[model samples]
Target: MTDADAQTAPDADVTQLEELSVTANRVDGPQAAVGSAISSISGEELEQRQIRVVSDVLRELPGVAVNRTGPAGAATAVRIRGSEANQTLVIVDGIRVNDPGTSGEFDFANLLNLEVERVDVLRGPQSALYGSDAIGGVINIVTRKGEPGPPRFRASIEGGSFKTMTGTASVSGGTEAYDFLFAGQGFSTRGVSTASRFDAVVPTRSLDHDGYKSGTGLAKVSVRPTEALEFTGVARYTEFDADRDGFGATSDGYPFAAAVDNRDTEKGKQFFGRAQAKATLLGGAWDHILGLSYTNQDRRSFAGTDLKTYASLGEMTRFDYQTNVRFETQGALPASHVLTFGADHTRDAVKSFTAFPFPADAPNPLRKHIDNAALVGQYQIGFFEKLFVTGSVRRDFNDRFEEATTYRFASAYTFDQTKTKIRGSWGTGVKNPTTFELFGFSGNYVPNSDLKPERGEGWDVGVDQPIWDDRIVIDATYFQQRVRDLISSETVPDPGDPTGFVNRPINLAGTSKIDGVELGLTLKPINGLTLRSAYTFTDGQDATGATLVRRPTHIASFNANYAFLDDRANVNLGVIYNGRQRDLAYDAATFARTSVPLKAYTLISLAASYKLHQNAEIYGRVENLFDKNYEEVLTYNTPGRTAYGGLKVSF
Candidate 1:
C-alpha cells in the first residue's frame, strides 16, 4: 500500500521562503519581489545555536568568509564573494560603524549578540542605495523592539575553558503611548598566544598568553502618540581592552619571528546612537522616515606595562531622509508600482599622534576632516503576480574626489504552476580613499592626495527549485565581478636624503577579477529533523594572472538539527571545511615577503538544550569537538575543544 503512494508522490523540495522581508536596501519588499542575492537569519536560530558572535553566523553563509587574526576580541574581518574585507558595509541600528581614521574597514570583534531580532545580508555591489564602501555587500542588524506587554526581565551567566566568563541582563516593556528597553553585557577571556610556537625561529621559547575584556550598555525608547506617527531613539556604548604579542627581540633570543612575551596593549571605546521619526500618510499610500546617527571610536596603543602614549580618534555624523509612494490599479488582477527617494549627508574627522618620545611624536597633531553628500532614487513594478522589476540610481559628491554616479537593475519571475523563482541583478560600486590614505600618517610612508576612488561592477543570476512536495529545496547562483584603480605603495626618490627611496601610495593600472558559484540545499525529511548544506567555488585573480591571497577555491558546510522529548529537548550538529589557500610570509632577516600555502582543515560542533519549565531552560555546547589543530591566519592559534554550560530564566 505504501510503495504505490511513495512512487506517485509530488517531489517538491521546498517550503515558503520568499515570504520573508528584504531590509538590506532603502526599498523594502517581499524577498520574492526583489532580484538580489539575499538571506535572513532569525533570532530563534541564534538562540538555539548560542552563537554569541555575529561573524560565526556569517561563516556558514553561501558566499561569505570570516577570519580573525587570533582569539576572541581580536581583529576580525568578513569578506563576501571574493571581495576585500574593507569593501563590505556593516550597519547597526542605522548607524555606520566603519573606522574612518584607518583603512575604513569595520572590525567585527567585540560585537556581542544582544537583543538582535534578525540579520539581513545582501550580496553584491550596492553603492546605488548605500553609497561608498558597499562594493562587496551589506549587513544589517535589526534589534528587538518593545511591543504592548507587561515588564519582562532576562539574565544569564556562563563560564568555560580559557578562563572565559560572560553575562548579560535586560529589561523591556511597552504601553500604548510609550516603550522602553535597557540592557548590559560583560565578557572576559584569558586567550592563547597570538604568536604561535610554529611561527617562532626558536621553537623552545615559551610564549605568554594574551587576554581580552569588554563591557557594553544599551538603551532604547520610543513614543507613539498616534497610530500613523512614531519617534524612536537608540544609544549603545562598548569598551574593550586587548593584550597582544608581536615580532621582536626577547630575553632568550634575537631576531625572533614571534615574540615570546611582550607587554603591548590596545584599548578602544566606541559609541553609536541614532534618532528617527517615521510617518505613514496619504491614506496608507505614502511612508517617510527622517533620521540622524553618530558614531565615535577612540583607540590607544601602549608598548609597556606602564601604559605610556600613542592614541588615535575618529568621529562620524550622518543625516538621512527617505520617502516611498505606492500606486495600485483597480482590476480583478491588480498591478502595483512603487517609487522611493532618499538623501544622505556625512562628515568625518580623525587625528592620530605618538607621545612616547620618538620620531613619531606629534604633540600638536594634524587633524583632518571631510564631507560627502549623496542622492538616490528607486522604482519598482509588478504585473500578473509573477513578474517583478526594479531600477536604482545614485549620485555622490565628495570633498576630495570627483563626482560619482552609480546604478543597479534587477528582475525576477516566478512560475505559477511549480512556484520556481528565477532572479538576476547587475550593479556598480565606488569607494573613496580614507582620511589616513589621503593626508594622514608620517615617517617611512607618504600620503597621496591625488589618488582616485576605487571602482567596481558585478552581476549574478540564480534559480530556486523545490522537490518532494516542499520537503527539500535547492538554490544555486553564479556571480562575477571586476575592480580597478586599486591602491598600492611604490618607491619614490627621497626628498631629504640622497641615494635612498621612500614609499608613496599610488593607484595601480591593473584590475582584479572574481568569479564564483554558490549552491545550497535544505531537507526536512521527518518531524523535528532538519538538514542543510552549502558549497562555494571561487576563482579570484589579479591582472597579472596570479591567484588572490587568502581566498579558498573550495568551501563547504553541513548542519543537522532535531528536536526530541516532546519538543522540550533539542540537539544540533555542524561541520565546516575550508580548502587550502595562499598567504604571504615576511622574512625577519631580510624583510622580504613570499607566498606560502596554508593547509586545509575541518571543524565540528555539537549542542543540546532542555527546558525545565515554561520560563526556565538549561543548555550547553562543545566547540571544536575533534580538537582539530588548524590555523585560519598564518601564525595565530585558534581555540580547541571548548565547552560551556548556562541557565536561562525569564519572567
Candidate 2:
C-alpha cells in the first residue's frame, strides 16, 4: 500500500477501500486487502462538518457514541461496542496518549480538530497490533505531514452563537532533504449554565456560567540525509481551561447531573514529541526502524469554595516514554513471506492529589511508577496468490506486578482476483488500574493495591464484497470479547450507619462479554454522488447476565454527498440514530432494580460548501436540522437546532 493506492483506488468500491485501508494496520489499499471492520473519515469531511472537536468528527461513525459530560475542554468519554471508556486505546501519531493518572483515559473534550489529517477506527479487539487498553479496539488519529512541494500558507477566522470565536493558521513546505509543517488553532465560547435533572435536594438551576478556552499547536520536520537514512520528528502541545459548577440530589439518592456549572477552573496541558529513524541493514534485505517518544500531561482544578465534602481541588500528572525497534525482512522464505521482530520498552509514572475534609485537612497525593519491557514478533505468509496467514506473539514484563503474555492468529482469503475477501483474528488484551482507582482522598472508600489487570480475549470475522459492476460494496463483520477479572467500584454497607455506605474498587467474580455485528454499504448511484451507510448491533452482558449501562444495543449512521456545479460545490446530508440504553443505577446497594430506560433518538444534519476560488471556500451546517432534542448522556441534554458556518483557504 502506497500513496498512489490511496489516491487512485477503483472508483467502483471506493468506500470499501477506505474501510480496508484504515482497519489493516495503516495499510493503504482496498477492502480485498484488509481483514477487519474499519472506518475512515477524511479531512474534507471534517471541514464540512465545521466541527471543533474530535467528538464532533466521531459522530459520523456508526457504533461509536460520545458523551459530552461538560463544556469544551472538560470531561468527555467515548464508548465503542458497549465497552468502558478505559478499554480503548487512543493513539496519536502511533503513540499512546491515554493519561495514566486519570484511569489511563484521556478526556476527548480536550482534543482539537485543526491538526488532524485523518482518523482510523478499528472495530474490535486490536491487542494484536497495540497492547493493553485496546480491549475494545483502537481510534488512531493520524496528523498531517508536510507535502512535498513549494511553501504554502493559509489562515481563517469564524464567529458563531454564545459569542464564540475561532481562528486557525497553517504553513507547510518541503524539499528533497527536509520538510517542515506547522499549524495552530484557538477556540473560545460562553457555555451554557448547569442544571440538575430530576433532582429535588439541589437547586434545579445554577447561576454558574461555564465556558472554556483552548489552544493547540503542531510541528513536524523530517530530515533525509541519504536514501538509506531518514529521520522524522513531530511534536504537539495543547492547553485549556474549563469552568464547572456543582452537583445535584434526587429522591433515589445522590445523583450527579451529567452537566453542571462550576466555580472551579480546570486547567491542563499535553505535550508529545517523537523521533524515528529507519535504516537499511543486512545488505538492504533487512529494514529497521528505531523510534523514541515522550508524552506528559498535567491537570488541576481549583475550586472557589471549600469543596472538601462534595468536591475536591484535584491535580493529576502523568509521564510516559517509549522506545521501539523493529527489523523487517521481505521475501524471507519466498516472494510473499515477511517477518518482523521488535522490542518495546515503556516507563509510566503518575501522581494524583486531592483535597478532602475532616481528618484529611490537607490535600493527599498518591504516586506510582512502572516500567515494562516486551519482546514481540509477527510474520505474514501468502499462499498461491489468493490466501494469507499472519501470526504474532508478545511477552510483557512489569516491575510493579506480574508478567503477562498474549498472542494473535489470523487468516485471509480472497476471490475474484482479490475483489472479495474474508478474514478472522483472535487476540488478547489487558488494562492496568489507574492511580485514582487505587488511592485517593480517604472517605468511605479503601485502596486496593492487589488489584490485577483486567484481561480480555476476543475474535473478529468479516467479509467484504463488490456487487453490480463493483459500484456497490458491502461489508459485514461479527465480533465477541470476554473480559475477566474486571475491576469496578462497589458499594458496601456502612457499619456505623445502616443506610450509609462505602465504595471500593474490587475484582469482579467473573467475566463480562461483548458481542456485536457491523454492516456497511457504499453505493455510487451515478457519477458525483455517493451514499454510505453503516449499522451496528451490540449485546453486552456481565457474568450476572445484566445489560451494560450507558451502552445502546443498536446504533446507525448514514451520509450522502454530492459534488455538483462542475465539481466546485458540494452538498452532504447525514443521519444518526442511537437505540435505547440501560439507564443509570439509582440504587447500587440492591442491584436488583432494573435500569431506567434511555429513549431512542435520531438526528439529521445538512452541509453545503462552495468554492470561491481554487484556494478558498465557504461552508455552513444546520445541525439537529429538525431541532430534535436528544441526549448522548442521560439527563444532560445535547444542543438543539444549532447552526454554524465557517471559511477555509489553502495555498
Cα distance off (Å), candidate 2, residue 436: 2.7
Candidate models: Cα lDDT each:
0.77, 0.68
Q: 173-232, model 2: which lDDT tens digit per residue? A: 898888888999999887655333433444334345567888999898889898777677
Give a tens-digit lDDT track for model 1, residues 429-541: 99888887786664445678898898989999999877788788888999998888866666666666565445667777889899999888889999999888889898988
How many collisions between residues are there in candidate 2?
4
Question: Cα lDDT for residue 151, model 2?
Answer: 88
Give the worst 10-residue stretch by lDDT in candidate 2: 1-10
User: For candidate 1, what is the TM-score?
Assistant: 0.92
RMSD of candidate 1 to true structure, Å: 6.7
Q: Judge candidate 2 at residue 92 and give its lDDT.
A: 74
